[model samples]
Target: MSQEQHYTFGVSTRAAERLRSLAAVFAPSTEQLLGSLGKVEAGALDLGCGPGYTTELLQAQLSPAWTLGVDSSEHMLELARARCGPKLDFALHDVSRLPFPAPPAELVYARFLVTHLREPVQLLRAWSTLMQPAGRLVLEETAFMRSEHPAFQHYYAYLAQLQAHYGQNMLVGATLGTLCEAAGQHVLDAGVRVREIPAAQMAALHAANLPTWSQDPYARAAFDAAQLRQLGETLREIAAGAALAPAVSVGMGYVIATARPPALVQG
Candidate 1:
């Protein structure tokens, strides 16, 4: 795996639970994006599928001939396989690399995946080569996040810094459309979907992720252990409703693009 693909949040059992909650929180927007595609006869590929919630969504929404969920972490793939039906298959592969184990897909979908990539435009170009001529490339990533709570704000700042250290961008969603165009794909649609998540829910998500990320070498070096502990406690309090805060507004940018014919690809 490339250094850029080193996910800061380790795939612990707690992280899997965090991902499940995250999938629930973001499902509506993801469903809306998939609905735009209607049905795909060829196949659908879910990149960085985590515990496979998004992969399940893809199957339900598109009912493609086949569905494959790929992730870099084998532990995540194991968790995904345990819950998924026979129709859904999970593969252990670094999504940032090319020549995936499966065949070319009719619809390639990734949610919160590109933010972890160093060369997102180049990866997009590689993905286009693995798609059918008319295949659609769908991406959903974080454009920005806003919260009134100091703990939440501080947590996001730390996350942004850590991702930057790994050559990734926490706010890569804002550039998805431009990246697609640069990759030689035809942009069909692109826009931001803003969602308001309850402070309690957001806190719970962060609390789950805290244990894993706070232990990272960079996080440990850059942040004080006592500060992280205090932040975790605050997040837990908010999650339990013992602390009150306003909802968090998150902006998710989505882009739907189609692979251009081989002749149309830029040199």
Candidate 2:
């Protein structure tokens, strides 16, 4: 990871729980992406694996002989190790650095990680080097997200600014397939996934996600703490009210990209 850019959502119990909740929400789509890949010859790695949720899903979906979850946060890794078994292991490393010493993985999977990097394409190129010939790289990222509530919209706008401030791309998912191609990977499947969460679920989702944002300096800088607190209260109130519930929906757009490293050229 670049010293200048940091993922503002620092590791915390609340953040960890929020990640696990998100993993659960996106599990089906992730499973679908993995299922589409068929089988693999070697190990699978979950890059930026938080709480090992996706790692577990990868094991279940692909049944790769070896599964490793890599994250920079030891706290998140602890949560992951607790949830996973011996078949699934955790590694502490900066994903951008790709410092782990191991054999090339047959599958490299990442969820919501690319947007945090300054040079996601370059990182993709580096990750491609960690793959065996024809190894698949699966990436999941948010293409776009919107909520029916104005407060949510207001929050996302600032979130986008914060990501920009950190030299990250909030909409990087939109161009991942092309980036994969630019990185000398062969794009096999690239598609968008649209999911609408009911008002209750949406409210719950934000409620879980808010804690990390609330405590984040970038979030506070983007929107004052008082406003974020009010938004939280509003989300709770919305969740509690039946009449207000069904009228609201949270729309999320995800891009799932699967690509393979170009076959090694024989000398």
Candidate 3:
């Protein structure tokens, strides 16, 4: 996936190393939604629902109740709908113009969606029309606060060098609090929770996410084969070194924006 297609070859070389050891140590937004729903559940809207991994997880947890995974990528939607089938719906819909059967949703959640978007607030506001009053709007983003890991320094430095050429916002590691607040909720609930994905699983994420990042129609223009190879070599070095942290603290924060009928933030 090239940069033009809104994808990155790898998320963060340094973070991936730490996350693998501490997968369970972090908070998952899906877990948060299950907590908020208690017993009663209605519908779920997953923005940027790629490959339907999270959507399928939600399906496993929330049964009988239907969930819709929406994305602009027709290919992604096809794969998602194929993976989950009609029991769990999938649509090739843009966040800006959500084309759901219903107007508002009981839960409108986007994981790793806002980061990719240049103006995610507009998309959030659009979801407001689709969310019922007091409904939940969850935006889970990975915050790149700072890595204290001694080994991560070199790997992070390399990633920064690569991103300077590929794209500045490749990882979408930015201010989640500001965006959540801008997309105002009567009660803005946001918190940072770190998680890890084991080396094996980290490898899987790379397997799954690398293709998307490389094939991006626009973004890849800046990507150099030699640079990517260098990054790959450096990441492998970091991944192989040491006993590894029990849990790498990656900024896997959950920023929740509850919907209001009248809406809080003015256009």
Q: Global lDDT of each model?
A: 0.88, 0.74, 0.55
RMSD of each: 2.4, 2.8, 6.1
- Name the top lDDT candidate: 1
Q: Which pairs of residues collide in candidate 2?
A: none
The segments of candidate 2 whose C-alpha lies over 4 angstroms from its true place after superposition are 1-4, 240-267
Q: For candidate 2, lDDT tens digit of each residue in 175-258? A: 778888887677876767777655655566676667777666767666777877887887777766633644333222333333
Clashes by residue pair, model 1: none
TM-score of each: 0.94, 0.88, 0.69
> Judged by TM-score, which candidate is best?
1
- Of 1 and 2, the candidate ahead on TM-score is 1
Question: What does candidate 1's lDDT look like per residue over 189-212, in tens digits?
Answer: 999989999999999988887788
**Quality of model 2 by C-alpha lDDT:** 0.74
- RMSD in Å for candidate 1, one decimal? 2.4
* Deviation (Å) of 239 in candidate 3: 5.6
